[model samples]
Target: MSSQFELLTTRRFLPFFLTQALGAFNDNIFKNSLMLLMAFTAASNLPMSTDILMNLAAGLFILPFFLFSASAGELADNMEKSRIIRWVKLAEILLMSFAAIAFYYELYMVLLGLLFLMGTQSAFFGPVKYAILPSLVNEEELIGANALVEMGTFVAILLGTIGAGLLMGLEQTLFAVSCVLVGTSIAGYLSARKVPAVPMENEAKPYKWQPVRQTKQAMRICFEQRPIYLSILAISWFWFLGAGYLTQFPNFAKNSLGGDSSVVTVLLCAFTIGVAVGSMLCERLSGHKIELGIVPIGSIGLTVFGIDLYFATPANVGDQILAAGAFFEQAYAWRVLIDLSLIGIFGGFFIVPLYALLQQRAKPQERARVISANNIFNALFMVGSAFSGIVLLGVMELSIPEYFLVLAVFNAVVAVYVYSQMPEFVLRFVIWMLGHSMYRVTHEDLNNIPDEGAALIVCNHVSYVDAMLLAGACRRPIRFVMDEGIFKNPALGWLFKLAKTIPICAKAKNEETFENAFKQIKAELDDGNVVCIFPEGKLTRSGDINPFKKGVERILEETPVPVVPMAIQGLWGSFFSHHGSGIFKSGKRFWSKVKIVASEPVAATSANAEMLQDKVQQLRGEYQ
Candidate 1:
C-alpha cells in the first residue's frame, strides 16, 4: 500500500511528478483567474457577454491540443524527454512572465493570447508526461505511478481553482495573481530540470511541422493496436463525461441547488477530492498490478452515482439562495455532494489502469505518438461535451438533472459497447471479483513463470474455479486447457469461452475434439502465450492429488516449451470444489484463504507427467 508513496521519495519519480502537478496547477490558476476576471470586472466592457467570453477562452485553451499535438508527439519521440520537459517548463515561465504584465495592465486580450500559449506548452508536454513513466519505473510500479499522477493532477486542479478565487478576492488582485502565476511557473521549471533524461531507444527522426499530415500518421500508429486504440477511446469518453459535469456545475448550482458561487466550489471540491482518493486507491485495489478488473467497478460506480445525483437534486429552489454552510445543512445537498464525490472516486478507478495499460502495451517507439492521438481525441470529446450540454440544457429544454440522467444512460451505452468490443475488460473484472470477494488468494513464487515467450503450467485439479483462480494469480493471460464438461458448464460457459479456454475430451469419447484441443494448445504456445492444464483432468473429491494424465505429455511433446509446475491448496472444500456430495452442493465459504505456489520451470525435454506431478505435490505439501 505504501509502495506507491515510496516513489515520491526517489529522484526518478518525485521531480517528474512535481513538474507535471505544478504545470496543471499553473494552467488552472491562469485559466480560472481569467474566467473570474471576465465574469466580474471585464464583462461590461467586453464586446460579448461573459458566457460567450468564457466559452471562447475554453476553446482557445483546448484548440492547441487539436492543432499542435501531432507536432508535439513528433518532438517528444525524437528528442530526450527530460530535455523536452525543461524546454516546455521554460516556455511556461516565459509565457507566465508575459501573463504577469497582462495581469498588471488588465490587458485581457494579451491574457487570452497567453492562455493559447499555455495550451501550446501543455500540448507538447502531454506526450512526454505519460510516455516517460515506463522508462522511469519498473513494470509492477507502473500502476502505482499512474495512480499517483492521476491523484496529483486532480488535487492540483482543485487547489489551482480555489487559489484563483482567493487571489481574485484580494484588494490587489492583479499583483497577487501575477506573482502567484509567475512564481509557480518558475518552480515548475526548476522541478523539470531535476527530471532524469530518458533517451529514445531508436535513432531520432527528422521533425515535421505539418499538423494535419502528422496527426493522420499518429492516428494510424494509434489504430495499429486494437487494445491501445480502444483504451484511448475509453479515456476520451471519461473526459467527455468529466467535461459535461464540470461545464454545467455553476449553472446547476445556481438554478437547481439554489446556491451561491461558494456552493459551486463545494461541489467542485467534492468531485476533485473523490477523484484523488480513487486514484490513490487503485494501487492498493490492484495489488500494484495494472488490474483492468476494477475498471468496470469504476464505471458501475460512475453510472450508479451519476443517476443518483440526478435523483438527489431538488425539484425547485427557494426564494433566497443558500450559502455553502446553509447548503450543507440540507439533507438532499449531502446526497448530491456524495454522488459527485463517488463519481469522481470511481472516475479514478476507471482511468488509471487504462493509461498504465496504454504505456505498458504500446510499441516503445510509437508510444508518444499514440499518447498524442489520445490527446487529440480527448480535446475533441471535451468540445463535444460542451455542445451536447448546450443542446440538452438549452435547445432541448431539459433541466440539469435531466441532462445528468441522459449522461448516465449514455455512459452505460458506451461502456457496454466498449466492453462488447473488448471482452478482455469484462473477463478481467470477473477474475478480479473472484479474488476480492470469494477468496483471499495469496501467491508464492509466481515469478517462476516467464514474463514473456511460450510456457506451459501444470497444476493440480481442486475445484471448478481453479482456472479462474490461476488466471487471477498470474500476471500474464493464460490459455487454460479444461475438460469439455467443465468448459461447457452452463453456469460458467461464457467465462471460459471469454478466457479462450481450450476444451478437451478423452480420445475414447471424441477423437476429433481431443485432437483439436491439442492443435489449439499448440497454436497458443506457438504464438507465445501461457497455457495451463490441470493434468489430473478432473476435480479431486477426496481432497487428494489425482493421478496425472498422459495428455500433458502429448502437448509438451509437440510444443516443447518450458513447463512450470504449480499447486493450488485450501480450495477442496469450497462451494465450487468436489469435496462435498458433488460440485455446488456444499456449504459455501466466503473469503476462503487460497494459496497458489509455482515451482521453477523445467525444460520441455525433462518435463514428464510423473515428474511434474511430483513437483506439484511437493509444492502443495500439507496445505490441503
Candidate 2:
C-alpha cells in the first residue's frame, strides 16, 4: 500500500541482492585470483606468456556474454526468472569445483574453461537479474531501487576484488577459492529460490533451436526502438571507457607514479569508492528518474579528469615498491585518489541511468532480448577495448597516461555524437546544467496529481517559454496544447515539434486544425498521458490570467479522468513574456529567472473552464 521502495526492505530484495552480490563477488574472486597468480605466482613455470595468457583469459570470459547472451535472454524470458537464477547459481558450484581441480592439477586450460563456464552462468543470469526489478518494485521506486542495486554491485566488486587478492595470496589459494565459491553458490541458489516468479518478457518470441539464430533475432527486435538502441550504444561506450580506465590502473601505478602493489590498491579503492559514492547519490540528484544529465556530466568528467591525470602524473619513471602507509605519504597519492574517485563518481552518474532507463523504457514483450542486445554490445566493446589496448600500448609509442588521454577524447567524441542524434539526453543535460548551476527551483503540490493515468493539467499561459519551464519541473512528459500561431512560429515551432506538442486553432481560422488537434489530444489522454492546456487560449497580454475557453470542458467531455491545476509564477514580467509590451520588451534571452508551480488536481467531469481559471489565478498570485 505504501510504495515500491518500501518493499525493498523486505526479505525478497535482500536475499536476491545477497545472492547477486555473492555471485559477482565469487566471479571476480576467481577471475582476478587466477590472473594475478598466473602473472606473478607461477611466472617461471607457466607455458604461455604471462600477458598473453592473462589477456586470453580475459577475452574468453567476456566472449560468452556476447555469443550466448541472446539465448540467455530467451531462456530468462521463457522460463521463470527465479528458477533460471537458481540453475545459474547451481552451475557456478560445478564450475568452481572444476576451477579448484584445474588449479590443483596445474591445468591452465581447464582453469580457463571454468572461467568461460562461469561467464556463461552470468550471461544467462544477467537478463533475469535486471529485468525482474520492474516486476518486483513499483514504477516510482525504480530509480531508488536501481541505485541501491547498482551501489551494491560496485561495492561487491570492491570487496570481491580485495577478497580475491587475499585468497590468492594465501598458501592454500585453490582450496580457499573453491570453498568460497561453493558456499556463495549455495547461498545464491537459496536466495534465488526465494525470489518471486517473474515470467518471460515476451512469451510470443519463438523458442528457436539455435542460440545464435535466437540471438540475432532478439538483436533485431531490440534495435527497433530508437531510444532503447541509443541506450545500448551509450552503455557500450561506457564499457569501452571503463575497460580502458580499469586496464590502465596497474600500468599507471607502476610507470606514472613510480609505485607498485600498494599504489595499485590505492588506485583501485579510490575508483571503486568514487563510483559507489556517485551511484548512491544518483537517486537524490536525479529526482528518482533515469536522468541522462548525469550521463553527459559523467562523460565530461571522464574527459577532463582523464586528461588532468595525465598532466598531474608525477614526473618520475619505472616501478618502485611502497607499502600502504608509504604510498599515501606522498602528496601525489591523494591527487591520484581524488582523480580516480571523481572518475568513479561520474562513471556511476553515467552508467546507472542508462541501465535503469533501458530497463524501464524497454517494451515489456522484448525487455530481456533488449537487455541481451545490451550484453552483446557490451561484450563486443570490452573485447574491442582489450585489442585497442594492444594497439595503443603495443603498436603505438604512447605512455600509459597518453593512452588514457586518448580514451578521454574518445569518450567525449562518442558521447557528443550519440547525444546529438538523440536530443533527449542533450535536453536533460541542458536542464541539469541550468538547475544545478543556477538557483534552486522547488515544486509544491506536485504529488497532487497521479503519477500515471490520464490527467488534464491547466496552467497560466505565460509565454512561449511556459512549456520548457514546466517540462524541466516535472519528470513525466507533457503534451502541450499550444496555439497554432505559436506552433507555426519559425523560432519556437521546431522546439514544440521536438517536444511532440499538440497545436490547436480557433474554429474560425481552420476547422480541420481543431479537429485534428482534438483527435490527437483525445488519443493522448486515452493513452493515460499528461496533457497541459492553457485555457486562456493564448499568451496573456494583460499580465494576468486571460478569459477561459471551453477547451477544458471539451477535453473532459471526451475523456474525463483527472484535471490537474497548475501555474507558472514570477515569469509574467520575464523576457519571454511581453511584460510591458512594445519598447518595454526586454530582449534578454539567457540568464533569466523563472518559476513554475502546480496546484492540486480537480475532478474532471465536474470541472469548468471558469473554475480552472480561478485555480490558475490562485497559484500564479505572485510575479517576478
List where candidate 1 sits over 4 angstroms from the true fold: 584-591
The sequence of per-residue lDDT tens digits that candidate 2 reaches over residues 284-341 is 7887666777788888888899888877777775355666677788777787778889
The positional error of residue 515 in candidate 2, measured at the CA in angstroms, is 6.6
Model 1's C-alpha root-mean-square deviation from the true structure amounts to 1.3
TM-score of each: 0.98, 0.89
* Predicted structure with the largest TM-score when compared to the true one: 1
lDDT (C-alpha, whole model) for all candidates = 0.92, 0.80
Candidate 1 lDDT tens digits, 402-482: 999999999999999889989999999999999998899999999999999999999999888899999988999999999
Clashes of 2: 2
RMSD of 2: 3.6
* Clash counts for the predictions, in order: 0, 2
Predicted structure 2, TM vs. truth = 0.89
